[model samples]
Target: MDVRAAACRVEAPASRPLDGTVVRASGDSVAVRVAASRLRALGCAIRTGGAPLPPDAPAGLLRVERAPWISGGHALPECRIGWSGPVAVPMAGERDVQAACGIMHVHGRATGGPRALRVDYASVCAGVLAAQAVTAGMLALLRGGTAVRAATSVAQAAALALTQYVAVATTDPGSGSSRPEPGAERTPPFRSAGGVRFEIETFRAESWLRFWTGLGAERSAIAAGWPPFQQRFATATCTLPPGLQAVAAAWDYPAVRRAAQAAGVGIVAVSDAGTPLPPPPASPWRLRPLPTAQATEEAPAPDGRPRTGDGPLAGIRVVESANRVQGPLSGHVLGLLGADVVRLEPPGGDPMRGVPPMAGEVSARFLALNRGKGAVEADLKSRAGRETALRLAASSDVFLQNWAPGRAARFALDAADLVAVQPRLVYAYAGGWAEVLPAPQPMGTDYLVQAHTGVAALLSPPGRPPAPTLMTITDVLGALISAEGVVAGLLGAGRTGAGVRVETALADAGRLLRDTHEVGDRTADATAPVVSDLAAMAADPAYAALFETDGAAVYSRAPWTFTRPSDHRREEP
Candidate 1:
């Protein structure tokens, strides 16, 4: 209940060093103080800019503190942070909050979904990332007295929620378009005979095949494609209309559970019984310091974008050699905070580049994360490619990769190799699971992590099979976590001139969801309205602006703003 760790006593340092100023403006000084305390916990020697707080300042960074879910789950660090200045932004109020929610709402309307799902979808995801941002900023400060600022808008958070399927470009060339196929959006729930609900997921092609084989059902029982609701019937046969029939209705929960276990597929029961899921087992983030080898800090900067800007990570360089969502998204976050990121691809380019919904040769999803980044081509298997990659590593402050376990070292691209090239580099790695094994599994994926880590079990609604949360929730979370670790490493290197290795996995990200103790966990909100009329929301001028279209594509305004001195101009260095 005490999200601020108010009862925990943090001894102040005997003497404080003069650091940068933090300009904070929020009606809730308590929330501001909480954020300040987090920064101080990181050992930041910051002073609040001594200025008057603006009257109509938008939520700014402090909105993260006010997020309903922040105070729950894992407790905040214990140090008390102090500030001296007032903040600005004359045009912010409740309207801003509604406007932000409204923007995501409009996006949902464009995609077609229920209003309730729209309202909280972005907020929940944003809240998670917001909390991570605060923690990451603190981590950076703790590593060194770096003046790091994390500013994210509700809209940005909303956009992140959509990352799972947005422009889910298909690899199948015959599909003719990059848009996701119908029914690919969600894995539907099926009702059991006793009116209970449950769900199952197959992250890989082999999974559902195993499910059918385990049930001793004909292979034909499996759907031709990855439809979320193919198993709506309880009959062992696959010949049933989805969404109309309660397939599991023929079996009880235990029977269904047995069948899924026999198949070796992941499954969970749905509950509308209003029981909240348990909190995460451990803290969402774990930062461990690793031993470092002494070396000169003269690593050559990689050839890529000339980062010309000012922010927490200004002048920092990042080399990204990962693909799909997690690695690129982490690089994307670093870019947002003013890091110069260079994305490495093979001769043909990233596999994601070929996905459909293309503006040109690249997919929108690729553009979303890869924009503002420098790009290069390399063949990691080739001697020349390895040398090129090494050069890039030698010339960078950070290097991130999501290659399968042991694959990096095989390619001579692991942390040890890179650290040898750039000793002060912050090397980050993302993976599918946390545990290291002698042998690698087939592949780690977001869906599998959700099922394995009890995320599906917790999200299961009453009377329905267990279901996954948003597609790739753990994937995105893992990326954010990895990004935080990278920043922390960078700050640490800044202070001690020692390189560090940061690692995160999709499997570990599932723990963040578990750790999230919902705000006022309850079955019902007596004060809340039953439903919101989309039409009424669309009628408002401010809300309507959110739906504005630019030709065939719809455009949105940035949901949040940063007032950092370094944010003044974005130019190529």
Candidate 2:
């Protein structure tokens, strides 16, 4: 993907000037390169140096660095490196960090392999996050706040990527029963009689039953498979009975597809690695300015005083109505940045709140992302609920939602509607496909998006059927992209005094991941065996430090650390 082209396409034309130099220390890590490339695309003059910048450098200068571990206090013992088949080589400490964070465990469980080992993923995510932090710091300086320095580690990034897994593992110790033994082959990407490999997605039990029934699957087998199949998103493991696989294998690809279409199921043929992927979106997220009568105000220059307390978005307010991982995790990241987030839920609250593996009555999965956020109960289908939503948006700096494409417009609470009342708000929508794909869209869930965008093929082992890792890859990454969009929109709003609409989709996130990483045949050294016990690793002192538990619920610590000049003391002369 052309990083510069994507950046140029979404450039904040109406925002205040972002003129400055981004000084990057020389580093070979993919994370460092990604961050520098993105910063340069944002119009920051890039300067590479082997040494740290001089203390007397220009006030506009910002430094970016990538490290194996940001804590810099304790050194973790190097563990055995597992075989990284057909994936990018692991950088220094990459595999170790990922192992400690339980990423490999989740991947291995989902793929039915010893361990789906790779490091490129965490590094890429860290790079995007670093760029986000730099942008926020820049925004703070433009708002007359003190200059700030931000730092992140590959470990922290991996931890953030596995936040949901940590939540589930900590809350329910028995969840490990679903993990497949090493060398076990799981079913999902079932092979047809015609030698075609494909994946099917069905949301409701009826759809699952109908699809299997049309394919001549046994009633008992279909009924037994539904629980595990539906729970894969949360458990990261799906073990379907052999009868279901046999039923699929009996039919040819076209016949299987016909059955799926007749049953209202989503199906996609597994792509090959050599197949060319569709061009990625111009940008992962779209930002558009909203017309408002409010007059723009010139941004105040930096005052040189150190920014104190909280994060860059200390005083910002975000109102979010999101479900599942993508939307809630976006709001969670915003909260970590010190924004006050108020979650708008249905009158009885989000049903996800009752999902199993409870952490003191609240769902551990829900608590992972919505821990510190405030909640508001409103029946969005009702007029009073819409009024309440509008009232909240009128006073908030950002309004985020991930409802179906037309649900917001139907409720009269879309970007146009909210901006009419609060002209300076930043409205963000995190959807499944956006407007990129044709209509009659498949369900906009993570695994389906993976199959549609060829991500399933990219991660599959050589000669294996294409299968999406049940790790919620696109959901987590989409959330990160959405948060980045919200921050960018906020910056644009600050500069122009007008509302902005930020839109991103799961497909876009999948495309970004697919286009950025190049998959090849070079495999890593397989000297050490794969680690299997995630719970044991989580309890280890070195890994335990990365997470904190609250009432049996565990969550990752903040990924980035911010420091200002005031954090240090002046020497007495």
Q: Against the true structure, whose lDDT is highest? A: 2
**Candidate 2: misplaced stretches above 4 Å?**
1-25, 52-91, 111-113, 178-185, 291-295, 298-309, 519-522, 526-531, 566-573
- Residues 36-144 of candidate 2 have per-residue lDDT tens digits of 6655644455566554423322111235332111122111110011122111322244454455456777887765544544326676677667777877765554344
Least lDDT summed over 10 consecutive residues: which range in candidate 1? 81-90
User: Each candidate: what lDDT?
Assistant: 0.49, 0.69
Tell me how candidate 2 scores on lDDT: 0.69
lDDT of 1 by residue, 302-408 (tens): 45556567444667788999987789888987887667889989997887665545645666556656767888999998989999898998888888999867789
Q: Candidate 2 vs. truth: CA RMSD? A: 8.2
Compared with the true structure, model 2 gives a TM-score of 0.84
- Tell me how far the alpha carbon of residue 528 in candidate 1 is from the true structure, in angstroms, after superposition: 12
**What would the C-alpha RMSD of candidate 1 be, to one decimal place?**
10.5
